[model samples]
Target: MVKFLLLALAFGLVHAYAELEGTWYTTAIAADNVDTIEEEGPLRLYVRELTCSKGCNKLGVTFYVNANGQCSKTTVTGYMQEDGKYRTQFEGDDRFKPVHATPDNIVFISQNVDRAGRTTNLIFVVGKGQPLTPEQYEKLEEFAKEQNIPTENIRNVLATDTCPE
Candidate 1:
């Protein structure tokens, strides 16, 4: 009986150590204009929640990954702010299939089907902890610039209102 209990506990621990098991906010960087040298600001994202039905039956909200590679929920919902505003609402299917999951990061590709059933590709990346680095920030800025998004209004948007958490 003790051996069985220990085995079960071990299994549980192993299952608990999987990465990319929390809420992460990501932004896409696009180019603004050809002549401009600086990239645009990073877009903020709120993952809200993640649910897996087919392969993994787990729901994660605000979970943080430890240095030892264990994920634990600090709260029911994780709150994060990206550098810039979101161009559109974060809406889509309730369940997202995992293309990749690790202790530190998760990447999932999903399709957002509207009421009319028009589908759009949605790519999500959730980091376990910490924010984007300076280099990453630069990359995002460049991407925004490429997209031709005006930088003049980004500061206004970020300063005036609070995005949904």
Candidate 2:
């Protein structure tokens, strides 16, 4: 019976993640003590969550930071607890404490605290309406260059270098 229960629990976790797997996006990004960068690279929101009670039972998020069109892992995967709170340690690091809006809702915000104890928030919106147009992408590229925003970091979100439509 114990073994069976463990197996069931494992499957349940997998199912939970599957439910949360999808593409998400946001137009604005702001960080604590850091100047807000209105536009950046691609906007792909990769998330996996479990269960829900006006929120997710469990939630894990993965995102990359742009550094001169280069990509790097900035936020490791982390999830919320049963109490529905992200204000906890992720990847075994205490510096980063997070909090989110709601898992069940179409829109949610992931609030994170940096090593300096500054708060940074990641806004999440579901669906990829349409890829950015060439003109739009180029304009964004120019802005990214001006802002020194990395494009490679957002490659996953873009899916393709050019617009799909």
Candidate 3:
């Protein structure tokens, strides 16, 4: 939301797919509805990697999800649309937009419509090489607030040990 220089830079360069391709770890997420991301929730995803190919027209995302105390891996390949959103099918009809990217981290705003026609909005943050910094976490919280998502809904994925290595 341009509240900080780093976040401002990230939002401006969202089209730079090169910076978004790499292994990434789940850092934090904020959702309009907490149950969608709570323990064993359908949208509780931990990203493993992001691969952008074909001049950034296609995006491959590999992630892990914990359900029934078991961690499972799922990969989804989304095609980029003219509107800069990647459309893919996963738990439902999913679409995501890269909202921010830096050398070490990236952020996405995702919308998912489940089979029951329920829509969920989520802001996901992922970091590479190392865990996210406190300042970065703060920025995420700020960004979530601007999206009308309560900062309290922000969950620190790294703080949990449910996901697999």
User: In model 2, where do residues sit more than 4 Å from their true spots?
Assistant: 1-19, 25-58, 73-75, 87-105, 129-165
In terms of lDDT, the poorest run of 10 residues in model 2 is 91-100
Candidate 2 lDDT over 17-117, as tens digits, reads 45555544332232222332223332332332223333343344545544355544443434455454444454223222222222332334445454566
lDDT tens readout by residue for model 3, 32-130: 988998777888888988998887789999999988889999999999988889999988999998888878888999999999999889998888646
How do the residues 52-137 of candidate 1 rate in per-residue lDDT, one tens digit apiece? 22223333443222222332323232122242111222232223344545555554433334445544433444553345456644
- Each candidate's lDDT (Cα)? 0.36, 0.40, 0.85
* Per-candidate RMSD, Å: 13.1, 11.5, 6.3
Global Cα lDDT for candidate 2: 0.40
> Could you arrange the candidates by lDDT from highest to lowest?
3, 2, 1
When 2 and 3 are scored with TM-score, the better candidate is 3
TM-score for each predicted model, relative to the true structure: 0.38, 0.40, 0.86
- The TM-score obtained by model 2 is 0.40
- Between candidates 1 and 2, the one scoring higher on TM-score is 2
lDDT of 1: 0.36
The C-alpha stretches of model 3 lying farther than 4 A from their native spots are 1-15
